[model samples]
Target: EGAVFIPASLAYLIGTNIFGPLAYKMGRSFSSGVVNAWNELSIPLAKKFEHLLAPNAGWGFAIGMVDSAMMPIMGHLVDLRHVSVYGSVYAIADVAFCLGFAIGSPAISGSIIQAIGFKWLMWVTAIVNMLYSPLMILLRNPSKKEEKEVSFNINIKILLTQSKIKE
Candidate 1:
């Protein structure tokens, strides 16, 4: 069970290296969409070749690629829109991420697994993942609204006043 995620971790490292530059060239949303498309496609292929290690590895790789690429896009968007309160934005995002992945996903997946079993769940999730790619590709970066620029200028003067401390 734990061993299965090794391929995903490796793929994440590789995807980070590859997509960092690609994001700069192609735009973050588009790059993310491409990686997600890879992820969406990998599941069916893995289902088809369920007996092979390679297809499962590919599925892991694709998942890693999507995660690696999509994770930063949220931060980028937050920075663009909420530069003043980016810290708060990040905190909220972190909580949401933890809740979704750690709690919601497992709970939902357990129910889904019980209801339909694992094989159909993969297919269903793959279709859902496929649906998101088009939205990512079509996403237009929002134009940053002009805000009153805050200037950082500090003038500090320390004056030591000698006072009688001892009487």
Candidate 2:
């Protein structure tokens, strides 16, 4: 989405004489900072809210969607204004967003769970957004022996197939 939006927004800005490589650079930097902050906060937020809610829940997804929508808008804003001002504004917003995620997530989850119930939890989450979290429990890692066997089988198959094609 960032890839898609950055070019489009840049093109629009370029048409209006507002786009420059510096703008792109600043936007990319801002995006990296925002993503890093979100990832760092996610685990702590999940842990804090865990007792009140379940894993594989939609809260992370909700926050992700909001962040996604925000990035391109921020990019455009920085493109439209002076770099120092835009950077400062984005810094402030980033701080607010991080603080909000850190503080609000657990509080919100606890309140929702208390006021209603887990059923309402799913409903409230679903109504607000949608995202699928994979079940890690259903996954398995290959043993060392199994890994060697799979690699050997793949190599043998490739050799036989190549020899046959040479005929």
TM-score for each candidate, following the candidate numbering: 0.63, 0.34
lDDT of 2 by residue, 24-61 (tens): 43332333234333333343344343432322222333
Q: In angstroms, how far off is 29's CA in candidate 1?
A: 5.0
Measured with C-alpha atoms, the lDDT of residue 86 in candidate 1 is 63
Per-candidate Cα RMSD to the true structure, in Å, reads 8.6, 18.9
Candidates' C-alpha lDDT: 0.58, 0.46
RMSD of 1: 8.6
Off by over 4 Å in 1: 27-52, 70-72, 138-140, 146-167
Over 1-167, each residue of candidate 1 has an lDDT whose tens digit, in order, gives 55655665676677667766566456554544444445545544553333334444555555545555554666667766766556666677678867989886778889988999766776666666667766765435665645544221111111222223332
